[model samples]
Target: MFASNPSKRRQMILLVIITFNIISTWLHYTDNALFLSQYPGPEWFTSVGVISAVVVMTPVGLLGYWFYSKGIFWLAYLLLGLYSITSVSSPGHYFFPMVTPISWKMHSLIWLDGIMGVLLIGFLLWSSVVLKEWRSTSVGN
Candidate 1:
């Protein structure tokens, strides 16, 4: 029902992106032992890292969903736009071109985060124009 509105196509695109984000976050944190191995045992951090991630990301995804579904597409898109930029920008080293696929294999998280960031940004820019046209035409009719 949320996606049925012509002006809300951006919401559909973002739903896909956010869903993938949630899945990726879950996959990255699923193995507790592996996650713990990556960090020094702070006891508290080791116990709480995965739970914290779920707590934080879930509400964000849900809020985005709610905003878009309610036709407040711009608000949802704005939040996600900010998120995507930060995710991609966080790894400062990867901004320059990397000429080889073989070399690319080593930095999976950086690549995934960066790529998702690009996708989200691209979609937002495109959908802004689309929603604008739709609003103008819908209002005219």
Candidate 2:
């Protein structure tokens, strides 16, 4: 019945985000593989997909740990912000449907990406404000 501490809440949020991002990225890879089976994209496209996925997921996962440790929330926020923005924009056009008449199955992913982007951006902005306050308080002390 006791209220959770703010840091604990933040840790929970970070964990949730990291889990969601990992699952989403894995699903994207699965979808890509299936799509490629029928219609293989250029080699460069696949390479880019693999590289970008690594780049985005690695930092996100690391940042979540950082958040849990209460060590670098600002950096985590920045990384999440970048990931969210890129996800929304279809970074590297990796999310673009490979086949014509895109199946209904993929729709959920598109929507998820969009929603996560907005949420992450909002979280990032809120964290930035918190960071500013923390900095000011420390400076004052």
Candidate 3:
């Protein structure tokens, strides 16, 4: 459905961003920290972190599929973009502990997560422009 529109380029970009966000979110919850120091937060906070990640990421996944099927590419892009920003900022509570650990694996995961966050933010900004254009055209017609 996205093949016909000028926004297709942005749609493709957003799709990549959303796919990465979903994968990163899943990996973040599944990966094991090799050291206690690499733990994302206090001992008591890990479960909360997992749950929070699930809550946020699940909707993005679902909405992403909806956008694909309905051709609402801008909405998908916007949601995923917002999701990325929120994921990055909300986890600040845990990021420090996770990265400071002695294990290389944990450090790698932290780096990956940081990259995903940056990509998501970039996609969000680009999607916003596409969304604005879509809105203007829809309203004018």
Which candidate comes out best when scored by TM-score?
2
lDDT values for all models: 0.54, 0.53, 0.58
Give the TM-scores of the predictions, in the order they appear.
0.55, 0.65, 0.64
Steric clashes per prediction: 0, 0, 0
User: For residues 46-101, what per-residue lDDT tens digits would candidate 3 score against the true structure?
Assistant: 65566576677668766854664355657766666666653464345454544554
Model 1, residue 54: C-alpha shift (Å): 5.1
Best by lDDT: 3
The collision pairs in model 2 are: none
Q: Write the per-residue lDDT of candidate 2 for residues 1-141, one digit (tens) a residue.
A: 114455556556656765676566556555655564433345555645755665666576566456434545555566666566534643333444464554555555545655565666665566567544234322211
How high is the lDDT of residue 65 in model 2? Answer: 51
Ranking by lDDT: 3, 1, 2
lDDT of 1 by residue, 1-101 (tens): 74566556645657788777655445434433354444322345453665575556567656755765665666766666655653455244344444343
Q: What stretches of model 3 exceed 4 Å from their correct place?
A: 1-4, 32-38, 48-52, 64-78, 90-100, 129-131, 134-141
RMSD (Å) of each candidate, 1 decimal: 7.0, 4.8, 4.7
